[model samples]
Target chain A: MTKTKKIPVSLTLASNRDKSDHLAGFLSISPWLIGFILLILGPMLASLYLSFTDYNLLSSPSWVGLANYRSLLTDARFLKSLEVTFTFVFVSVPLKLIFALALAMLFNTGRKGSSFFSAVYYIPSIIGGSVAIAVVWKQLFGRQGAVTQILSLLNITDANLIGNPDTALSVLILLVIWQFGSPMIIFLAGLRQIPIELYEAASVDGASKWRQFFNITLPMLTPVIFFNLVMQTIQGFMTFTQAYLITGGGPLDETLFYAVYLYETAFEYLRMGYASAMAWVLLIIIAVITLIFFLTSKYWVFYQSEGGR
Target chain B: MHSNKRLLSDMIFYVFVIAIGIVMIYPILWMIASSLKPATEIFNNAVSLWPSAFVWENYPSGWAGFGGIGFATYFRNSVMITSIVVVGTLLTGSIVAYGFARLEFKMKNILFACLMATIMLPIQITLIPQYIIFNEIGWVNTFYPLLLPGLMGGQPFFIFLLIQFIRGIPRELDEAAIVDGCSKLGIYWRIILPLLKPALVTVALFCFMWTWDDFLAPLIYLNDASLHTVTIALRNFMDTQGSTSWGPLLAMSSLSLLPQLLIFAFFQKHLVQGIATTGLK
Candidate 1:
C-alpha cells in the first residue's frame, strides 16, 4: 500500500501506467477476447485433450490415452473421407488456381469493358454454395436435364451426369472451379503490382514475351502465387457446402468430404466428442501441409517486400 | 507487341478467356432461364439459351408456402437478421478494433495475437459447446446466439480488418481529439467513426451477406416454424415432412436470391475492396 500516487522512478511509473492500461485494454477487448477464450480457445484446448479420450456428449471424457488417434489409424470411414477430401483438395485447387490466373491474365488485357467482364465472372463466387445454385445445378444435370436437351440436337439422349457416381464428384469440382473470381481478383492485383519497367526492360533485352514471363513475371508474382496456393489448398480441403447441397455426398458417398462427414457427425448425430477429435485431426493435417509450405517457401516464395514482411 | 504471333496469341487468349467466362456463366444463365421455363419445358430447353414460353408466374408459384408461410415473410426475416447483425457488428467491432489498434496496454500483443489465432479454429469445433451454451441459457431458438455475437466484437477476421484499416489513418487524429478535450470513446465515436466509412461499409457488407446466406445456424437453432429464417425454411420445404413441389421451390429460391443479388450489385465496389483487403492481409 506504500505505492506512490505520482512515482518519478521509471520502473514504478511505467508499471503503474501499464497496470491501468492493462486493465483498460483487457476490459475493452473483453468481448471477443473473453468469447475467444471461453467459447473458442477453451473448446479448442478441450478438443486437443478430448482427442485422446472416450468421451461422448452424454458423459465425462475418460483418459483413454490415444485410443481415438489409434482408432483413426484403423477407421475406414475416416480414412475414406481423408482420401475424398484430399482428392477434392488436389483436384479443385489446381483447377481453381489455373482458371483464376488464366482469367486474370485475360482480364489483364486492355479490352473494352473488361471490368464489366470481371464483375460478371465474379457473380458465382458471391452466390456460392447457396441451396439455390446447387438446386440449379441439380436441375441442369438431372437425368432429363439440360445436358440431355443439348444432346437432343445431335439425336442423342438419356445420358445423365449427376446420377453417375464417378462423374457426380466432378460436378462438385466444377462448382468449386466456377467460383474463381475472388482468387482471380487477387491474381489481377498481383499482376498489376508487377513493375511495368521490368516487362519493358525485358522487351529491350531481346527477351521473348514467353521468356519475360518465365524469367521476370513469374519470379515477381511467386509470393502471391504461393500465398494463393496455401490459402486455396486449406480452403479446398474444407469443402462442404457445394458437396452438402449439391450431392449430399451422394450417389453412394462419392462426394462425402471430410468437413461434410464432420458436420454430419457433429450436428446430425450429436457425437460432439468424436467430431471434436475429427476437427483437431483436420487442423493437424492443415498444420502439417502449411508447415511444408513454410519450410519450402524459401525455395519458391519470392517475397519482394522489404525482407519478406 | 502486335507482331502477328503476339496478335494471334492475344486473340487466342481472348478466346480462351471467353471460353472460361462461358463456362463460369452458363450455369447461372441456364438457372435463370429454367426458372422462367414451364415445368414441362424446363428439361426441354435445358441447353437452349432461350425458353420457348416463359412461365413467369413460376416465380410466385415457385415461392409458394415457404414453411407454410409466404416467401415475403422469410425474406423479411432475412432482412431483419442481416440488418441487426450488420449494425450490431459495426458498433462493437469497430470500437474494439480501435482499442486494439491505438491503445497502449500491457499484454496487448498477447491478447491480440490470441484473438488472431482463434480465427484459425474452424467453426465446427466451437459449434457443439456453443449449442450447449445457448441451450443452457435458454436462447435455443432466439436471435440471441446469432445476433448477440456481432454486438460483441465480432469474428477476429473483421476485427483484424478494422485494426489494419484504422492503422492507415493518422494517429494525429486521436491526439487532435484529445487536445480538443475529447474522451477516448469520443475520439472513436466522433473522430474515427466518420473517417472509417470505407472499412465500416466493408464490414457491414460482409455481415449482411454472411448472415443472410447463413443456412447452418438457422438450421441448428430454429425449431419453431413461425420463427424460421429463409434458409432453413426454404430447405425444409424442399423436404416434404409433406408433399414437396419443385416449381414453387425454385420460385421461392429466386425470391430469396433477389435481395442478395441486389446487395451484391449495389455494394460490389465495397465487396471487391473487402475481399481484396482480406487477401492482402
Candidate 2:
C-alpha cells in the first residue's frame, strides 16, 4: 500500500517536469513563432487574398475574382519582363557556375598564395550588388566611358552597351557572371571534400588526367553544382539593383527584370493588387523551377554515402 | 631537366593567374582612380588607372553632401541601424536556435520544417501585405519597419545557422547544468551561449555587412531625405548631381564601400567559413 502511494506521487512530479519543459520550449522560440506568423505566414495569406482584389494603399480592397491574373496574360511589359528574366537566369547561372567550378579547381591545386588570390577574387562578389557598382557600370559602358574608349582603341567601335537594346541584358549578365566568387568558394569547399584517394586510385589504374577528371571529379561535384545552380538561378531571376540603376529596365524594356517590374508596379504605380498577383506568379515560377531541379537531381547528383547509387 | 620543365610551368601559371587577377580588379581600381581625377580627366583619361593629379577636394566636397545634409548623417544612420540589428539578431537568433536545437515539444518537427521553408520563401510574396500592415499601424515612414524584423529573430537563415551550430554542441553540457540546479533558460545563458561564441561572431559579421549594405528596406521605409541611409543618399546624389560631378559621385561611392571593405579585410576567415559551412550543409 505504501509503495503504490509513492509511485503515484512520483508520476505526478514527472508530469509536472514535462509540462514545464514544454512551456520553456514554447517560450524560447516565441520570437520566431510570432515573427513567422506576423511577417511571413500572415502576410502570405493576405497577399493571396489581395491578389484577387482591386486595392490601392489609398482605398479598401474590392474583390475582383482573378481579373489581375487575367490582365497579366495581356500585359506586354509583364511578358517581356518574364522573357528577360528567363534569359538572364538561363544564360548567367550556367556561365557563373562554369567559371566558379573552373576557378575552384585552380585554387584547389593547393598552390601557395591561393588563399590571397581567392580573397582578391571575392571582393566583387562582396560589393557587386551595391548601387556604387551599378553606377560605375553605367559610366563604364556609356558612349565615352572607359569600355567604349578601350573598344575604340581596338578599332571595334560600338555604341554605348547600356543604351543598346541588344547588348543591355548581356551587359547585366556579364556583371553578375563577374561576381562568381561566392560559388567558387562553395565549389572549393566541395572540391576539398572530394577525397584525393580517388584520383590516386585512378592514376594507379593508368588513367589519364582528363579521364580521371571526367570519371571522378565531375560526378563527385554534381551535388555542389546543383546547389550553386539553384541558388544562382533564384538570384538571377531577382536581378534588380543592377538593371534598375544601370539601365532602368530600358532601351525599350529589354533589361526589365521581374522584380524591377514588380517594384515599379507596386510602389511606382501603387497598383498593390496587381503587384500582389505578380508576386504570386513569381513565387509559383520559382517553386516550379526549384521543384524541377529537385526532381531531376536524383538522375545526376551523386552521394558518396549511398555508395554511388 | 624535369625540374627545369616544372619550374617553367609554374612560371607560366603564376603569370596567367596574375593577368586574370588584374582584369578582375581593374574596374574597382578605375573607380578609385577616377574619384581622385579631375572632372575633365575622368572621361578623357578613363582608360588610365593613374591620375596625373590627385584631387583632394573630392573627399571634402562629397562629405559636404547634397542639399545641406552631409554624408556624415547617412553614415551615422547606417551605423545606428546596423549595430542594433546585429545585437538583436544575435539575441533572438540564439534564443530561438536553442529552443529548436535543445528543447523537445509538441509539433517541433512541423515548426522546424516551417523555419526551413521560410529560408527559401521569396520576400516579394510578403512585401505588399507587410507594407500594408505597417502602414495601418502608422509605422510605414518610421525605422520600426526596418528595426522590428531584426528584433523579431532577423532572417531565418541566421536562426537555421545557429541551430546547426547548437546541435553540434554535446547534450552532456546541458545535462550537467540541469544537475547543478540550472533552469532551461539558465543552461542556455550559462552554457550554450558561452560555447556559441564562434558561431555568434560569424552571425554578427554577416548581420553587420548585410544591414550596412541594405538599400531596399531603407528605400521603402525611410522616405524623409534627412533619414536616408548611405545607399539611398548615394543614389539620390547620382540622380541630382551624377552628370555634373563624376568625381564627387565616385568619391562618395568609394566612401560607402569602405566599411564593407574593412570588414572583409579583417574578418575574412569568418566570412569564408560562414559561406563554406552554409553551402556544404
Top model by DockQ, which number? 2
lDDT of 2 by residue, A157-223 (tens): 6868888998989889989988988999999999999989999999999999899888999999999
Worst 10 residues of 2 chain A by lDDT: A1-10
**Residue A172, candidate 1: C-alpha displacement in angstroms:** 0.6
The ten-residue window of minimal lDDT in model 1 chain A covers A1-10
Model 1, residue A167: what's the lDDT? 84
Assess the local accuracy of residue A12 in candidate 1 as a C-alpha lDDT between 0 and 100.
Answer: 79
lDDT of 2: 0.89
For residues A116-176, what per-residue lDDT tens digits would candidate 1 score against the true structure?
A: 7787788888887676777777767667777655765588544767778888887788788
Q: Tell me which residue pairs clash in candidate 1.
A: B62-B248, B62-B252, B63-B252
Name the regions of candidate 1 deviating beyond 4 angstroms: A1-20, A53-63, A148-158, A306-309, B1-16, B241-244
lDDT of 1 by residue, B1-281 (tens): 55998888767766866776787778777767766777766655557667788778877775556436776667777778888888878887887888898777777888888877766556766776677668767999887777867777887788988989889999998888879998777888898889999988888877777788887778778877777788777677766521235556666777677776897789877777666657721
